[model samples]
Target: MKKIILSLIVFGATISLASAQILPAFQIGLKAGTNLSSLNSTASETFSGSNRAGYLVGVWTRFGAVGFNFQPEMYLTSKNVDVTSSSGGVTRAKFTSIDVPLLFGGKFGALGLGGRFYTGPVVSFAIDKNQSFDSAAGKVFSLNYQDQNFAWQFGTGLDIKRISVDLRYEAGITKQTYDGRQTRISLFNLSLAYSLVKL
Candidate 1:
């Protein structure tokens, strides 16, 4: 019993020391953004759709010191898209999902202001029972059920003191179309984040 307790205590101390050496600072922040999204068709078919606007609100946490950082964020995002069929009918779809992103970044510059570039993978899970098809016209449409999606995002930002502004682009890797057709989500995001707590 004594040997086991000593080993556990030593292991915990080693882990704490390693963390203190590698990551000296931590921050928690709030972020809000606008999403300009479109439903894009695969090469085999043609899709007629217009870009739709949506909003995102989230909480994010960052760890590490000056040059390198790792961030994880959770967001409530509105994913809206417009689609038009060959029969001249339009259907608007609205999907609400929870998004989690793990980002690795590099920060540079001096003084109280700096610049950062980041890239990450995002996983999104749908919260609704079915993919809601709102307001449709022309022909009857069958909506695809996409409960989860995977995407990648890359962006650059300006970080000033406790706040940051970012411009990012995201591309969906998983196709979310029914009827043997391929479709994906693509979007541009502009966001502002404020650090609420620093440790």
Candidate 2:
């Protein structure tokens, strides 16, 4: 925890020093959104849909030009899965992760339209995991789910002045479960952000 804070401090200092001489093409923002998440695996299951509420708060920096930019962010995400059985109603499985993403974007502006296409990598660390099931006999299964993995993201956004709205899709490139099972997590996120400070 201390190390993470120190690293962020160092990163902020580095960015500050680097922007001192440049044209000051940097901005910071906060983001919040929902996540449509699920696991793609070979395990036998009877689940139909799994959508959950997730949010993120972080600072972002954008370099010059509407053509290319790099944005890095840190956020806390909540992911949940809903399962149903033949005789039962529904079950819920929830997981939380701390994620850091580094993204690159391309922007286009014309005809009163402005938007950007962005894609990048994300690293996540799981904080909690649990499952609940509703069955004929109220059957339940619980396992210590691991959620440390690297993920790839692709998305687009609209940028207007100090505010931006983005939609992104994320797919895990590495497995998260500890049982050597081929399981992957994916997220569809919508975020709104405001520029905290501009340089």
Candidate 3:
């Protein structure tokens, strides 16, 4: 009987210690942002495009340990390009894609309220209604774009209370053909994120 009582006491103590030590180092959040997007050419063909504005809205989860964290996010994003042809005609093409990024990073200064930096590869899947093209020559064309593409992202953010403000740049790693011309896309993103839960 005495051994049984002692064992119960030890178990209770262990449970209490675990509860005290294992606090929530994970956060879940929502983010919205804007993108300044453009295109570049690597082939012999010359491509000219103006910077276009796009939007992003997403959900993200981050797991942190010892001032470092891994963040993975999914978003509905807009990507676009506006090109001027040699005949002084302009074509505006827009794309919609689901973007997924897994970022590994470190935080500095304060634990929950500080600055962070991350770099990661992102993959995007094109959705239906992916492309809309309009030209100044009264021509409208819609083509099924490439289904998937990859990019590299570098970003920095500042966390204040439950809000984070971030700036990021993404560069394309593969060539995607647009209107029979080989080109790649890149963008600058500015975002604001809010923490919804931490447990």
Candidate 4:
């Protein structure tokens, strides 16, 4: 956790420095929302449908001419997934990650009527994991695990004044499981952020 804290501090300092240099509109924000997450595999087993509650808090700096700006942010996120068997059983999995995203987009109108598009990569560190299984025999089992992988996020959002809403798709690029099994996990996040300051 020390490394994550340090990285956040460094990222904050960098944003501060960039704001001082460019004198652009800088804003720090907090966002909280839900994530719809699931895992997809090439192997023909059907996956389960589960919804996870996730949130993010970050600092962002926007710079450039009117109608176009570049924004970068660092945030902490939580993701969850629950899988059920076709015959009616359930397994739950959860993950927490710290992510940094660099986004580029623009504003449309003075009243925040237009739409903005942004896409970027996210670097994440998994902090926790939990798995639970429900059997047909009325028995339950739980497992504790950890996943540390470098992931990627690319998606778009809409910015209106101090409030920005975003929908992002995230995918894991690194394999987290053993047994030489390669699996891919993906999620869709609907988030709302409030800008805190303008520099």
Candidate 5:
């Protein structure tokens, strides 16, 4: 009887301690941001990439304890870039996709203000009407965009009450083929998020 009572007490204490550590079990928020996107050639024909402004709007959710959490987000985004070659060939690209990112990160600080850092895999499914674009005149190179883009994102953020700001860098892990040449994409993202529900 005493052993059973002790076990019950221990279990209750553990639960209480865990609950105490978790300020809120979950949070849902809306975030909107702009990104500067660029592309790089990974083939024998070297080309320079130029950045263009792209935008994203999404909803995100975070769960687990405050110190460490899992964050997942879904967003509609545009990634655009311009490429220029030494021979004065210019190509412009606009890609729109639905993106989902699964991120794991941690937070530190106290008194309702903290800093966060996260790294994750973000997958993008293209929704653009056109998947391929014409090459510049006299230039055999062209962009053949894939239906799915796989990338990684890592960044840091600051939280003040219900509003947070994040700055992140994203790089493609897959290639977007251009004729016989291949290219990669990269972006820098800045976003503002507001928590609609925090519990």
Candidate 6:
């Protein structure tokens, strides 16, 4: 038991030492990922909502010390959701928007690896100039897309050299309207990013 404990301590010390050796002051990267989204609502008038897959592509920049940093990201997001009304009517919404998230987080590392936990507000702007949905004409509720929306995100990330991965959960701070019925969007987003510039 003593030998095992000593070995573990030695390994941890080595990792911590390596981590302190390589702390970058700044970095920039590009990322792409997929998301699963569901509609959340407490309104009695609403029916059911199911999850749907979506896509996100974007770029990110990070700055500060090794233990604490400020990260900002901009991405183009495509979201899809399927909602069923009480009257058995269904609507499929596929919307595209531009998202900007300003994140503040702390990071820790071992050896050549690191982890980060972050929280931030994400502001989304609608870019559905062509139309938010392909068809909502037949649904029981008429769909109307919002021009802008706000949400909060909490997530963790991993960093290995120049590569990083992030998993985040987002919940709406305000309700969005579709057919005049208000609902919140809740989603899980997973992304892979590569740093192009690290200083």
Better-scoring candidate (lDDT), 2 or 5: 5
Question: TM-score of the candidate numbered 5?
Answer: 0.82
Q: Give the residue spans of candidate 4 off by over 4 A.
A: 1-24, 46-53, 84-89, 111-113, 136-146, 178-180
| lDDT value, candidate 3, whole model | 0.79
Which parts of model 5 are misplaced by more than 4 Å? 1-24, 129-140
Tens-digit lDDT track of model 6 for 100-161: 99999988875549899999999999897333322343445544557798999999999998
Q: After superposition, how far is residue 171 of candidate 5 from its true place, in Å?
A: 1.4
Relative to the unseen true structure, what is the C-alpha lDDT of residue 101 in candidate 6, on a scale of 0 to 100?
94
Candidate 2 per-residue lDDT over residues 15-126, each given as its tens digit: 6655432233677777777778876666545324456666666556777543567888888888787654433456677878888999987666643256888889998888
List all candidate RMSDs to the true structure: 9.2, 12.5, 7.8, 13.0, 5.2, 5.5
Score each candidate by Cα lDDT: 0.79, 0.71, 0.79, 0.63, 0.83, 0.83
List the lowest-lDDT window of 10 residues for candidate 2: 16-25
What's each prediction's TM-score? 0.81, 0.72, 0.79, 0.69, 0.82, 0.82
User: In model 1, which residue pairs have backbone atoms overlapping below 3 Å?
Assistant: none
Least well predicted 10-residue stretch by lDDT in candidate 6: 129-138
Query: In model 2, which regions exceed 4 Å deviation?
Result: 1-24, 43-49, 84-91, 110-113, 135-140, 176-181
Tens digits of lDDT, candidate 5, 1-199? 9999999999998876564445556899999999999776655456667789999999999886847889999999999887665455666778899999999998876666888999999999999923333355435345677889899999999989899999999988779875556788889999999999988
Per-residue C-alpha lDDT of model 3 across residues 74-188, encoded as one tens digit per residue:
9999987776554445667788899999898877654457889999999999884444444555444332257798999999999997899989999987677645677778999
